[model samples]
Target chain A: MTERISFRSAQKKALDIARTRLLVGGALLAAAFLVIGVRLVDVTLFSENGPSRQANARNIAVEKKMDRADIVDRNGILLATGLKTASLYGDPSIIIDPKVAARALVGVLPELSEADVLQKLSSKGEFVWLKRHITPRQKYEVNRLGIPGFEFDEEERRVYPLGRLAVHAIGFTGDDNKGLAGIENSFNTALSERSERVTLSIDVRVQQILRRELAAQIKKFKALGGSGVILDVHTGEVLSLVSLPDFDPHTIKQASRSEKLKEEFKNQQFNRTTLGVYELGSVFKIFNHAIALETGVANMASNYDARKPIRSHGFTISDFHAENRWLTVPEIFMHSSNIGSAKMALDIGVAAQRKFLTDLGLMRRSSIELSEQQQAIFPAPWTELSAMTIAYGHGIAVTPLHAAAAVAAVINGGILYPTTLIRRDELPANGKRVISAQTSADMRKLLRLVVENGTGRNAEAPGYLVGGKTGTAEKPTAGGYKRKALISSFIGAFPMNAPRYVVMAQLDEPKGIKESYGYATGGWTAAPVVSQVISQAAPLLGIAPVDETAPNARRASAIKVATPRARGQGIATN
Target chain B: MKRPATLIIFGLAVFAGAMLFGVAFEVSNLEDRLTGLNKEITRDRDAIHVLRAEWSYLNQPERLDGLSQRHLELRPLEGRQFSDIAALPMRPNRVPTPTTDPVSAETAPAIAALVNAEPGGLPSAETPIATALTAKPKLKPAAPRRPARNVRLASQRISPEATTSTAASDKAALDAALRAIFGNTASNREGASR
Candidate 1:
């Protein structure tokens, strides 16, 4: 009985030890599980910078960035955009038959030479680029060839959808996607760094209209080239700027590199609207008239003796169609009298004229968003002869853009706003008042008179109430002026009661056409172009035609020129 | 009791581990799906970029102008074709009687032909109405024509000629004829048709 009791005690002691060890193991396991659960929750729910979130953030950063931003017109029409394309590359090592692969690629991409591609595919290097910027269709065609060694590297290409339409404005990019000219060059950093589109103030519709009309005129007149600009007068926004003989951006690199096309390529790349400064003849009279009235040196009734040519400093200033009689202020402008304008300029003097021209932004390079702008060539000496010739648009060379912007200021209630190719949500608040409202009003009347009964009659777009001045400059040679090679141009504003837009059309060396009565003058060549542009563009611009026959309309635009008293009949009658 | 508790705690630990493993597997599957979706989105975005460029190229003004010249009879809008709503004479309550009316016979058949010619009915209906209202005609159309044509005539109300009586009578007859055809729904049709 004693031996049995001792055996039971030993068994009990072993059970107690095993039970205690089991409880300890369970508690340790629970603690480990709790720690793991807490760690999981902390990593997932509580952690501020989780691995998954970090990966997502990195992916978002990659997705948001682009090589270049798109360029769009004011109407959000795509002008220039970046297209991600695939470039075909060959693995020379893996290519089974280089000849067959190259032949296949040549068939798909005809522009690629078979021999060159064969050489590349058969080369020692492991990789070779066959073509860059392959279209999706081309990539698909290449894939269908079942070439084992061919692959594509993703790349971004700058594409101008409108081709050559706005090339000078939108510019072109190089193979490295770097801008080389025009707006692309000017806003390179902005375009490269930002993903947002750049919206320019160009209207593609109006640009087409201007381009079509200008090209038609250029073809008809047998002119060397042409440039045209249409600017919103009130806001100083360029609606359309066109320089003809513009080249397609795609061919620019090839054209530039070609030895035979070097001169032609440079000529085509020239942005004439802002860069070519010419002695834009009678168009300067618009400024001359405005300056005369603003400085209180002349008025609508003021007269200048235009009977004889004014000879100064071995130069004789005479009108093309000379009115050999003493003329009234309005008569001189109506006839585009050079002698009268020269005399008026002498009266206004040099300092006032320079300051006025500077204020009108004509003396300096235009502040337009272009790198092609040239400073106006004004005489540094400020001689009497210079003032006289500059008055009639001689001795001073300014770009067509300068003349357009100045005219915009003259008609847009005398406020000179810096011309811009960028759209603004509001009218710029920084416009400087250059003339009184009354003087601007009177200038509008005088301008209308020119279109109504004077030299710019061809510029009239019946009910649009077009008003303008015509300029015809003889291209100056090394020795003297080349009378036959004329730069014919017209600067005009429409809806003259409240001018909304300023249109300038210029033709380089336009020959006389049969329809223009064989007169290769501004009124004959460029004025009709402006008339057609206004008639077509006015409707597109949402400008309504007024009843020009209304007494109020007729009377408002009318400027009475005092009759010349029958050539000194006042004394004769007395 | 201690033995059962120990087994239960070990069982709970295994259950939690199994659940954690299943959730981790599911989370990895979800992450893979997210990556796939992101790749698909990127591919779609690239395609859209290409399509947008092509769309812009096809809609170039010069190309559209050429296409329109070839395929459509419409010309660019002219300045004379626009006028203010205020410039339009007041709408006459009555339709004018057929007097000096050669245009309705011509315009009615022409309009009906246009309506039949067009696949979409409403645009054709509005185009003729706009042309008739804006184009000032010296001769008035018959009573069967729309009343808006009469409004164009009534704008000549300022004229001092004695022909006002005939015009006034014609307007009244036309209004009655229109009311007879459209009934009270004439107003509703007029508004809805435009």
Candidate 2:
């Protein structure tokens, strides 16, 4: 009986142990399944709402790829672009036979010398450059040579497709594809980011026309050089800006090594349109007349005595083409009379003249997209003689760009807009009003009178109603003005009934030609260029030509001159 | 019943896991294909960019001007050649006035008659267009009258049955008309060579 009782207790203890083991194992398995199920749900459902870490990493890799943006003209014509090219390189250490490799390379690239290639291939370096920016045909030929050590590196090179055309404006880049000049330098950051393409306000067609015409005149007159700027008066967009002796941007790297060629290249790179400042001659008369009319210091009927050369503080002021008599305001501007202009400036006073120039954006560095710009040279003390000479465009020197902009302000209904190379969606709202509308109209009429019967008669386009001023200033020397060297320039606006554009052409140190009747004056040299440009570019710009014989056009352009008391006075000579 | 139910749940879970894995594999394959296509697109874009730059370089205005002067007969348009729609002569009232020489016989006589009828000139009466056309008497006498006869003769000689004699004359007339339209081809070629 005792043994039976012991066996029963043992069995009960064993059964208890088994139940505890099973219960523990079952709980562990259930906990493991719960953890995995929660994890799977989290991964499949919540994870879809956000990007995985790997995807984020791939996106970063994509963003790191760098490319430069393209530059195009206003008409969507490609001006400058980056092209992919393969550069040839070699692993000299891997080359089996340096002489054979060099021979093969020289065969493919005739420009590369055999000695240079052999030296490079035999160098004790791991790698060396055979050539940079090899053409695809050459690259293929080199690859087909079955040379094991040779390799190609994919690279980008900036190319200006228009060659020498507008080279100064659409600048070139260095070997590393970094912009070193022009629009390239100014907008370097935007280009490297490859965010969007850059579109300039330049019309390639207009640029071609302006360059061809200006180059022809520069050759005809035998001038040292020339520069031209065409500005939209309403918007201040530089339609065409040209400087002569421009170099081709594409092959600038391979140019001849002669010192003279290098110096010529440097000179060609100097942008005269915005960088060079000159006394701009009588183009300032347009500003003077506008200021006189705007300030109410002179009117259509107001008269000044130009009967004799005015001597102010030992400085003699006269006109190149003098109408030596008491001259009305219209006659003063029409004849570009220096004595009349000085007397008128004296009436307007020095402070007012300075203020007028300052307001016209001539006293400061004009704002443009180009990094190459110089401030205007003006008299520091604002003396009486300074005011007198400045009246007829001396004592104050400005860039062709500045002169063009100021002329635009005078004829573009008196608002002064900052010049720009980039196209604008809307006209800038910050333009300051410099003159009254009525004064602008009266000034237009006087300008038209000058083009019609005065010194600017050569500037008239037969049916375009062209109105302008001619300026011929002797270049200043150390002691006095040079009698032979002259800067002849013409500033003109077309369809004077309502002005839309301002064109300025300047010739530097033009010599007299036989056809010019031995006179290298603006009327003979620069005025005809303006007429040709307007005649050709008008139809291109969609400006219709007006009928000059029509009664309305005749009446509209007629100038009323009030005769003065000193009409029969003696002639003034410089 | 409890054991069978547990076994059935396990089987369903295995089936679901297999489906999930299959879908994931398919998605990964498509993603790979998309990546390859993207790379191809990038390469094509780069190629197109290069081609466009080359095209622009080849089509530069200076180069095109030289090439056209060599191969084509064309001249730069002049401002005087442009006229307003109002300046165009009114189409004759009657369409049946067809004549052998359309340009010279019909139009020139009508223009001359109009100029004569009104002492002040055409009905537009002192339009600049009339003044410009009249001012260039040298151009009017030669340009308007000669091209008309040449064009008529060239068109009438298009028949295939023409003998060699007539064919030669036809060819000469056609050549003259082409020269007049384009410019002096011989002179252009010479200028290009120089």
Candidate 3:
């Protein structure tokens, strides 16, 4: 009986131990499951910091940058842009049958010589460029050949949409897309770093008009070359700048290979508007008269004896069409009397004339956004003769661009703003006031009278209220002036009531034509060009024509003559 | 009962785990699709950019001008063809009168024939409209020309002396017509600003 009780007790104790151990195992398994559930929730809902996600965001940010920016005109016309092109390259070491590959490439690109391609393909190099910037069509043609060793490298090529139309302004890029000239050269850094389009102030329509008119006149005159400029008088923005014999930037590099073509290419690449300096003849009288009136040296009523040629320092100063008579200030300007201008300059004296010309920005290189700017050729020793000659635009040589800017300042309320090819969103704050308001107004009236009754009569576009001056200077040779080789130019502004643009057209060495009655003067050669350009461009620019009979038109164009006797009599009447 | 309860909880946990895994796989598949679509979009954008550049190049002004000169009968707009609406003369006062005579209306057909026959040439005033109408019915059949002739006459009556108008007045008329076509709100605003 004692043995049975002990065995039962031992069995109960063993059962109790087994129950405790089972409970502990169940608790441990429950805790493990709960921990796994918590971990899943944390991973799905709470974890935001992952190294892979950050890497993805960083990669996207790095891919958005472009290699170059586009260049567009003021009206959002695309002038210069970059396009993705495929360039063919060959791995010489891996190329199977280099002759077959060269022959295939030559078939796709006819411009590529077989000898050159074969040499490149057979060279002992890992890689060599066969052609750079091939057209998509060429790339497709090449790909269709199934040349095993040849590969295409994607690149960007700068293209000018208008070709040679604004080639000098938009310029061209080198093999590696580096700007070589014009606004491209000037704003290379800005263009290379940004994808935003650079807008210039060039109106392509106006550029076409200017180029067409200048080219027609240049061809007609059989001249060496010509340059023209149309500037916004108020903003100093160059609307149109045309230098004749301009080259196509696309083919310039290829054309530069031939000796004769190379010479022509060099000539065509010369930006004459800002680079070539010439003695711009009676056009200087506009400034001369303006200076006299501004300095109180001469007034509208001031009379000068222009009855004979003024001989000073063994140099005879005579008008092209000599008016041997005493002339009023208005008459002197109307007839373009060189003697009277010299007399006026003598009265103003050399010091004042130099100061005025310097203030007008004629003594230094014009501040335009161009790399090819030449300083005006002025006489070194300021002599009385030099002042007299400069008065008639003889001793001073200035570029067409400089003349355009200076004239703009004179007519645009006498504020000289730096000329720019880029579009200006706001008026510049640093425009230098060079002359008084009264002088600018008087100058406007005088310019109108010259276009109306004087030598620039042909420059009038019926309702345009054209106002201008004629400049016919003889080109200087080794010893003296070449009378036949004349640099005839016309500087004009329109809607004289409120001038907005100043246009200057020059013909180099224009021969006398029969239609012009054997006269190759500014009025005959260049004035008509200005008239055509103004007539065509005014409508494009949305300038309204004014009725000549209107009181406002009369009031704006009317010049007050202090002397009543000089009013009815013609300036040329002796 | 406790053993069955444990089995049910374990089964539920396994099912939840399976659903979570399926959702994660689906999300991963959508993300991969999004990346592929983004790449395609970027490639398409690049192609569009290239196409726009080519379009500009092909639409160069000189090339268009050449093409027009060779294939189209159009010219650059002239300044003389433009004028301000204010410069136009006042319209003449008139009262409408319907003519019952078909002969008078027949003159319109002749004029229309003359206009079509000579595209750019103006009808000569020396050839009387009445005489020309009586002489030229053979150019086209006169059956279907009555209503067209009446409509032409009504348009012509608005400007009877249009052909004889001076260049300046013609320019002014064109200007007024353009202003009527394109509203004068811009000019009115300009005037207001001034």
Tell me the alpha-carbon RMSD of every candidate. Answer: 8.8, 9.3, 11.0
> How do all models score by TM-score?
0.81, 0.78, 0.80
Range of the 10 consecutive residues with the lowest summed lDDT in candidate 3 chain A: A561-570
Native-referenced Cα lDDT, model 2: 0.79
Per-residue CA lDDT of candidate 1, range B1-194, in tens? 89999999999999999999999999899878878888888888888888888999998888998999999987976665554333322222123345644344345534433433232334232233323332233323532223343243333422322234434343444454344233445544654687
- The best candidate by TM-score is 1
Q: Report the alpha-carbon TM-score of model 3 versus the true structure.
A: 0.80
Q: Is candidate 1 or candidate 2 better by DockQ?
A: 1
Model 3: native contacts recovered, as a fraction: 0.29
lDDT score of residue A149 within candidate 3: 86
Please provide, for model 3 over A88-190, each residue's C-alpha lDDT reduced to its tens digit, 9 standing for 90 to 100.
8999989999898898888889999999999988999889998888888988888899878889999988888888888777877888888888888877889
Error of 1 at B47 (Å): 2.4
Task: Give candidate 2 regions above 4 Å deviation.
Answer: A1-66, A90-107, A113-129, A145-149, A312-314, A562-574, B1-32, B67-194
Comparing 2 and 3 on TM-score, the stronger one: 3
TM-score of chain A of 2: 0.89
Query: lDDT for every model?
Result: 0.82, 0.79, 0.80
The residue ranges of model 3 lying beyond 4 angstroms of the native Cα positions read A1-63, A560-573, B1-17, B68-80, B88-194
